[model samples]
Target: MADLDPTATFKEFDADGDGYITREEFTAAMKARGEEVTPAELDSIFRVADGRDGDADGRISQAEFLVAWDR
Candidate 1:
């Protein structure tokens, strides 16, 4: 899985490689995975994966991706 891209987690979760993953996607990849999450969970998940510190920093780097996923 070294070729993995975590921020692209949604894309990977999309499975069929469609350009978009719908609420059903969120329901499956995130919620059904035991997140107890909802389709309306939050866009922040993406930003979080993108490595935004939300304190006016920049895009999340690859190292951040590893650390975040490691969580």
Candidate 2:
């Protein structure tokens, strides 16, 4: 099994514990990781992982992010 728990990652990224990661929270999380994503890059990445079903709005859910990143 993968070592990471995507649910946990999601929780961490969600920040406000609101069950969703807003764009601001997402950017903050990346910055916390010492990553500086340009606006264009962030938008592109978000669009890719927003989920095919749109159940997550435009945010990447923990499970979805983990599976997508693991590849």
Candidate 3:
């Protein structure tokens, strides 16, 4: 598989163009990209992503996304 561009991937998942991704947006994007995640796994993903949510909001900002992507 080709290397994925983190910025591009993050933007695509930010469906609302608000510069942040909610749980719903993340799930939809992952599913559309052919990823099948269980509810427990999804929760874990959210936890990791939201850990970078500086404002404690339920959304992942571009910066946070980049950090997660790099990891």
Quick one: best TM-score, which candidate? 3
lDDT of 1 by residue, 1-71 (tens): 23366657745556566544444554566554566664345355545644444432323334454576777
Q: List the residue pairs that clash in candidate 3.
A: none
Across 1-71, the per-residue lDDT of candidate 2 in tens digits comes to 23377677778789988776667888998788777878998787677777544664777666666666677
How well is each residue in 1-71 modelled by candidate 3, as lDDT tens digits?
12389888888989999998888898898788788768787688677777766466778888988887777
lDDT of 3: 0.80
Q: lDDT scores for all predictions?
A: 0.51, 0.73, 0.80
Quote each prediction's TM-score.
0.39, 0.69, 0.80
**Which whole-number lDDT from 0 to 100 does residue 55 have in model 1?**
35
Better of 1 and 3 by lDDT: 3
Question: Candidate 1: where are CA atoms >4 Å away?
Answer: 1-4, 39-71
Worst 10 residues of 1 by lDDT: 53-62
Q: Residue pairs in steric clash, candidate 1? A: 51-60
* Ranked by TM-score, top first: 3, 2, 1
* Model 1 RMSD, rounded to 1 decimal: 6.8
